[model samples]
Target: MLEVKDLHAFYGKSHVLQGVSLSVGRGEIVALLGRNGAGRSTTVKAIMGLVSAQGSVRFKNEEILGLKAHEVARKGIGYVPEDRAIFPDLTVRQNLVLGIKDPRKRGRWSVEEVFSLFPLLAERAETAGGVLSGGEQQMLTLCRTMMGDPDLVLIDEPTEGLAPKAVEQVGEFLTAVKKRGISALLVEQKLSISLQISERLYLMGHGKIVFQGTPGDLRANEGVRKEWLEV
Candidate 1:
């Protein structure tokens, strides 16, 4: 339910996104794949209005390009950055509470529901976020964001820096999110994990989308993979 059209973004003259266009339909998982400096993360940030952007961004068929970040979030979008910015000083419960909306809306999710998705967070409810391990912090950050009850989530590098098993857990978690009818715009470098969780993939190069297809189609297109994604 999100559409970005010919989006251009920059960081004070260093243009990072050039005519980037993509769409995530309802209950669909779309992976945005590219190497470093390909502007995948910038695409998400621009959609959130975290950076100035040119072009059209529509969420639920409403124009959202110029809205503030919170305004965008209020329109049923959640973002989990690669850094997993958990509040170090806050307890796990506190961090989760921060994502909770007041006077919860009809379609909103609750803390208990989020904990059900990440039970480890429930066990560490009282622990200080700073003292948690990297995997735990990542889980906490994701759980915190889920508490927002978003219609669509933009996740950046959910598997980065984690152990192999943790990466698998992230994969399963994303799969669960998909089954729950949550749409995702995933930006990931780990192709295998991303393919496992996504139905469609978009390969980007030099700040633009070069290929868009099913994961299986991408696997079969050795030529496109070599030209746009090979290291």
Candidate 2:
């Protein structure tokens, strides 16, 4: 559903993504794994047109390399940034309402469906987003993105600072996403979750994809893991 080829992105004079290439098939969950400075987040940002990027970014065979962030989002791609970007003052329900691209048309996701998936969100429906816990904020961001009815989502560090229980919740969220036939490009640091949920995984090093294979393949390749993934 999504393909990136020879993608290079820069931050001022520093080149962060160097010829990075990867693909996500329809309804598949692909994980991108690496150390802190391996440029994994930059890859997703470039794809979302949030940075200065060059090369080819195609969704369903159409090039979207130069499109603006909002334009790219309108093309059925949603992004959940590493920093949970929720409106602090808005109520949970109000924040979700903003994610609706069109109120007149019903999309694949509904507020009720999101509430069903995460009951904690339902309990906090009328509460201000800023007062929620970190885990709750994360869940809210994910649900808000789903409200846009995206065909694919680029999620960066969904489990970065959460507790084990919250991490499990994120795993459940990903499973729900796949069950609904939504594609995901997950940038995650937790190898256990990535290996458990992702059909395929890509290991990045020095701003490039050094290994791309199935979870089993990654498990069997100790050398690759030690070099590119293990800290």
State TM-scores per candidate: 0.96, 0.98
**Predicted candidate 2 versus true structure: per-residue lDDT over 15-120, tens digit per residue:** 8899999999999999999999899999999999998799999999999999999999999999999999999999999999999888998999999989987899
Tell me the tens digit of each residue's lDDT in model 1 across 123-183. 9889899999888888888777887888999998888899987887788878878888999
The most accurate candidate by lDDT is 2
Instruction: For candidate 1, report its TM-score.
Output: 0.96
**lDDT, candidate 1, at 207:** 84
Clashing pairs in 2: none
Q: Please tell me which predicted candidate would have the highest TM-score against the true structure.
A: 2
lDDT for residue 71 in candidate 2, whole number 0-100: 94
